[model samples]
Target chain A: MQEIPKPTIRRLAVYYRCLERLEQKNVEKVSSKELSKMLKIKDSQVRKDLSYFGTFGRRGVGYNVKELKEKIKEILGLNKQWSVIILGAGNIGKAIARYKQIEKDNFKVVAVFDVDKRKIGTQITPELTVRSLDELDEFVKKNKPEIAVLAVPADAANPLAERLEKLGIKGIICFAPVTLTCSIPVEYVDITVFFKTLVHFISRGIQ
Target chain B: MQEIPKPTIRRLAVYYRCLERLEQKNVEKVSSKELSKMLKIKDSQVRKDLSYFGTFGRRGVGYNVKELKEKIKEILGLNKQWSVIILGAGNIGKAIARYKQIEKDNFKVVAVFDVDKRKIGTQITPELTVRSLDELDEFVKKNKPEIAVLAVPADAANPLAERLEKLGIKGIICFAPVTLTCSIPVEYVDITVFFKTLVHFISRGIQ
Candidate 1:
C-alpha cells in the first residue's frame, strides 16, 4: 500500500469540512473548480488532491455533496466510532471534552483522567467522568481506545505520554507544550505556536 | 518584496517554536540542518525559508539562537503588541481569553463580546469583560483591535465576522464552522476538522 502525502491528507480534511457545509446548505453537487475557489487552492490542485484518494464524479456533473462527504469521512476513518479519552480535566482539557464538535465527528470521549485526587470521579461532561490517573493503563487495556487527548500540563505531559504509549494508545491530540517520542502518532495543538503562527500570518500581510 | 509561501511561514512558525524551546534550554546556536531535522523538514528548505526573510548567519558559525529567535519574532510581529478582541464569551472564547499563551505572544484580548444579554458586563477574564454584541462596533472602532477570535456559533459567525471586518479587524482566528469572506487573512481552528485529520493520520498507519 502506498502512503498518501500529509498535505493531501490535511487538504482532504478541509475538503470534508467544506462538503459537510455544502450538505448542510442542502447543496448536492460541487465542482472541483468551485471547491478550489472556496478553499483558495488552484482548481487543478483540487482535482489532483481528490484523485489521490479515488475517483468521484461523472461526465458534466460534479461531485455529489453527500456522497463526497461520506467518501472523505470514510477515507479519514470518521465512518466508524473511535473511542477516545481525555488525559486531563484542566481548563483546555475540559473545554475539549465539552466541545460539541468532537462528538459530532464520531470521536467519543469515553472518559477523562486526572492526577488530582479531587478531580477523580467528577463528571467533566455528562457522558464522561474524570477517572484517576492510576486507572488509565488498565482502563485503556480493557477498553482499547484508539486515541487520547493529552491535555496534561507540561511537566506531566511526557511521562503521561510514555505511559499512554506503553499502554498501546494509537493516537494523541496533545495540548501540552511537551513533545512525545512515541511510535504512535501525535497531533499537537500547541497554542503558543499556533497563536504565534497567526501573528506571523498577519505580520506577513497574508497570502 | 517577494511574498513568502505559506508553507514556509508555517515552518517558520515551527522553527520559532523550536528556537523558543532551545532558548529555554540555554542553547546558543543551531545550524539550519539541525533545525531542519528537528522540524522534519529538509535542510535546504530551512535555509531557503529563512532566506526568504533575509540574511541570518556567517559562513561557519550558523544562526545565533537568540538573534534568530528575535528575528523570527520580529518577522512574525511578536515584537509589537497586537490588540485583540474575542467575538464570543462562550466556553472556547473565554478559554482563549484566559489562555496565558496569547499574552506571551503579545496579543492582548482587549474585550469579549456576546449576543446574550445575561453575559454582557460579566467578567470573562481578569482583564476582559463580556460586552454586548451591539457595543462591538463602537468598541472596535475606538480600540483598533488588529485581530479577532471568532468563537461564535455557525449561524452568528458570518454576520459577526462581517461586522468585525467592517470594523477594520486585520485578522481572525476563527473556531466557528462557518467560513468568513473578509479580505483580511483568516486562520481557522475548526476542531471537528482538526480532530478528524488527527484520526486520518492515525488511521493511515501513523506516518
Candidate 2:
C-alpha cells in the first residue's frame, strides 16, 4: 500500500468535491486543467497530485468524471461505510450529529455518550440515541465504530481520549483544545485551535 | 511580500502551540532538529519553512524560543487585534461566541445576530450580545470588524455571505457547508465539508 501525504489527502477531498460538481453538470469528462480552473489551483499541480496515485487521466482526452470521482473516493478510503460514535453529546456533539454530510455513506452516528443524566436519555438525532459514558466500552465492543468524535469539554478531553484508545477506536476528531496522549492510532483535529490560530493570523495581518 | 503557502500557515499554528508548551516548560531555545522531533516532522523541513521568511535559527545553536514564537506570530499576522462577529446566534453561533481561545487575543466576539425577536436581546456570553439580523450593516459599520464568522445554517449561508461582503468584511470563516460565490475577497473554512471529507476517506481506507 502506498502512503498518502496528509496535505494530498485534503486535496483529494477537494478533487472529489470538484468531480461531484462536474457530475452534477452532466459533464462526461474533465481535464486536470478544467479542474484546476474550477478549484482556483494550478493545472500542473492538480495533475501531479493525481499522478501520485495512478494515471487516472488520459494524456490526449481527459478523465472520465464518474470514474475519476470513484477513483479519488477509493484513494481517500471513502469507499465503504464507517460507523461513528459521538462522545459528550454537548452542543458541539449534537451539532455534529445533526451535520448533514456526516450522514452520507456508512458514516452513521450510531450512538452518543454523555455523563450528564439530563442528556443521557435524550436523542440528538433520530439516528443517534444518547447513552451513558459507562456504556462506551460496551458500545465500541459491540458496534465496532471506526470513528469517535470527541466533543467533550477541554478538561474531560484527555481522559476520554485515553478511554477511547483503550476501546480500540480507529480515528478521533477532537473538538477540544487539549493535547491527547494515546497509544492507539487516532487522527486528532482540533477545530477550536485551528480557528483560534486563524483568528490570530488575521489579527496580525502577516502579509 | 513573499506569499506564505496555506500549509505553512497551518503549520505555523501547530508551531505556536508547541512553543506555548515549550514556554510552559521554561525552555529557552530549540534547534530545528528538536522542534522537528517534538512535532514528528522532518528537521530539514522545519529549517526550510523558517528560512522562507529569513534565517531565524543559528547555525549550530538553535532558535530562541520566545523570539522565534513572536516572529512566527508576526509572520502569520497575529500581532494586532481583530474584532469578529457571528451572523447567526444558533447552536454553532453560540458555540463560536463561547469559544475561549477567541477571547485571548484581540479576536473579540462583540455581537451575535439572529432573526428571532426573543433571541435578539439575549446574551451569548457576558461579552457578546445577540442583536437582530437587521443590525448587521449598522453594527459592522460602527464596529469596523475585520473578520466575520458565519454560523448560520446552510440555507442562509450564501445570502449572509453576500451581505457580509457588501458590508466589506475582510475574512470569513463559515461553519455552514454551502458553496459560496463572493464578489469581495473572503477566506472560507467550511467545517462540515471538511469533516465529511475525512469520514469519506476513512471509510474508503484509501491510505
Candidate 3:
C-alpha cells in the first residue's frame, strides 16, 4: 500500500463524521460536491481522500451514506474496542475519562494513573479508579492496554512516556504542552495549538 | 500574502514550539535539517513553511534560534494578548478554563457561559466566573472577547456559535465532536479525531 498523507487521514476522519451526520439525517446518498459544500473543502479533495481506500462512490450517483460511514468507521479502527489508560488524574485527564464520545467511539479508559498519592485512590468514573504510577507495570502486565494518554505535567511527561514504551504500549495520546521525544506514534491534543491557529487566522483578518 | 495551506499553519506552530525548546537549551542557531530531524519532517518542508513568512535565515549559518522563534511567534500572533470566552461550564469547559497553558500563551479566558443554572454564578478561577448564556449579549457589549470557545455539547454548539458570530467573535476553538457550520473561522480540538489518527497508524503498523 502507498503511504497516505497525514492530512488525508485527518480529512478522512472529518469525512466519516460528515457521513455519520448525513446518515443521522436519513440522507441515503451524498455526492462529493455535496459533502464538499457541507465541509467547505474542494469536491475533488473529497473524492481524492475517499479514493484512498478504493473508489466507492459512483461518479454520478455518489456514495451510499450508511455504507460509506461504515467503511470509514472500519478503516479508522473505530469498529474495534480499544483499551486505553490515561497517565494523569488532573482536570484534563478526568474530563477525558468522563468524555462520553470516547466510549461511543470504542476507546475505553480502563485505568487512570497519577503520581499524586492524594489522588491515587480516587474514582474518575464509577468503574475506573486512579492508580499510582508505580503500579503501571503490574497493571500493564495483566490488562495490556494498547494506548496510553499522557496528561501529566510537561516535566513528568517524557519520563512517563519512556516508562509506557517499556511496558509495550503501542500508541500515545499526549495532552502535554511540551513535545515528547518518544519513538512510538504519539498524537497530541494540544488545545493551545488550536488557539494559536485560531489567532493566526484572526490576525490575518480571515474569517 | 499568498494563501497558506491549513497544514502549513499547523506545522508552523510546531516549528515555533521546536524553536522554543531549542532556545531554552541555549542553542543559538539551528539548520532546517536539524529541525526536520527533531520534528521528523523533511528539511525542505521546514524551509518551505518558514518561506511563507519571509526569507529569514542566512544561507550557511542557518537560523538564529531566538530570532526565528520570535518571528514565528509574531507570525502566529502569539505576541499579542487575546481575550477569550468559553461557552460551556461542563467538564471539558472547566478543564479548558483551568488549563494553565492557555493563559501562558496569552489567550485569557475572560468568562465562561452555560445554560445550567446550577453552574452559573460559579467561579472557574478567582478572576473568572461562569455566567448565564443569556448574559452573553450584555457581557459582549461591555467586554468584547475576540475569541469564543465552543466546549458545549454537539446539539448546543451551532446556535451558540451563531450567537457568538453575531456578537462579533473573530474566531472559535471548538471542542464539540460535531462539525460546526458557523461562518467564522473555527479550529477544532477534536480528541476523537486524534485517537482515530493514532489507531489508523497502529492498524497500518506505522511507528
Q: Pick the candidate with the highest lDDT.
A: 3
Cα lDDT computed for each candidate against the true fold: 0.82, 0.74, 0.87
Model 3 pairs in collision: none
Residue A23 shift from truth in candidate 1, angstroms: 2.4
Model 2 CAPRI rating: acceptable
Stretches of candidate 2 exceeding 4 Å from the true structure: A21-31, A52-63, A115-123, A126-130, A153-159, A178-188, A192-207, B1-3, B25-34, B52-64, B114-123, B126-132, B153-159, B178-188, B192-207
Report the alpha-carbon TM-score of model 3 versus the true structure. Answer: 0.95
Supply the TM-score for candidate 2.
0.81
Best TM-score among the predictions, by candidate number:
3
Instruction: List clashing residue pairs in candidate 1.
Output: none
**Evaluated with DockQ, which candidate comes out highest?**
3
What docking class should model 3 receive?
medium
Could you tell me the interface RMSD of model 1? 1.9
DockQ of 2: 0.30
lDDT-based ranking: 3, 1, 2
Error of 1 at B159 (Å): 1.9
Task: TM-score chain B for all models.
Answer: 0.92, 0.89, 0.94
What lDDT is reached at residue A52 by model 3? Answer: 83
Q: Per-residue error at B61 for model 2, in Å?
A: 6.2
